[model samples]
Target: MNVVPDPITTQEQASKERENLLDFFARGLICTTARAVGADHGEPSEEALTKARAVADDYLAAYEEWLVKLTADNAAPGPQ
Candidate 1:
């Protein structure tokens, strides 16, 4: 039996995936920065975490913008 996925469910999955990516990126940045600064003892400092989140937000925004442009270009009609 073939089952078609609901559009809403697919959208939700994409949203969740983005959220997960943001988290992963932020965490990685935090760890990398901490190690570079020789502060990788335990948990990252509040300041480092904040900076990492900011960087992650900017990265995600740029990525989303590029994706939108790519999608729009692909959707445009070609020569008739």
Candidate 2:
């Protein structure tokens, strides 16, 4: 017999996938920033690394907000 996934389970799976994608993007952003910083100065200091992480966190937050707004706008019914 084939197993059927519940709606809630499907939503959960999608949420997990979105989180994973966000995390992957955030890490890549951090690494790229760190590499650029390191290239300029042999190695980045702890403070610099901390700042990079903070920036990444801020970026993710802003990105999430933008996505929410975009989704909401798209979901709204278009003018007749």
Q: Which candidate is the best by lDDT?
A: 1
Off by over 4 Å in 2: 1-47
| Window of ten residues with lowest summed lDDT in model 1 | 4-13
lDDT of 1: 0.81
RMSD of each: 5.4, 7.2
The collision pairs in model 2 are: none
lDDT of the candidates, in the order given: 0.81, 0.68
Compared with the true structure, what per-residue lDDT tens digits does model 2 show for residues 1-80?
A: 99975554577787776666555665566567667788434455566556655766677779889999988988899953
User: Candidate 1 residues 1-80, lDDT tens each?
Assistant: 99975554577798887777777888898778778999746776777677787899899999999999989988899943
Model 1 off-target regions past 4 Å?
1-15, 37-39
* Model 2 TM-score, all chains together: 0.46
TM-score for predicted model 1 compared with the true structure = 0.65
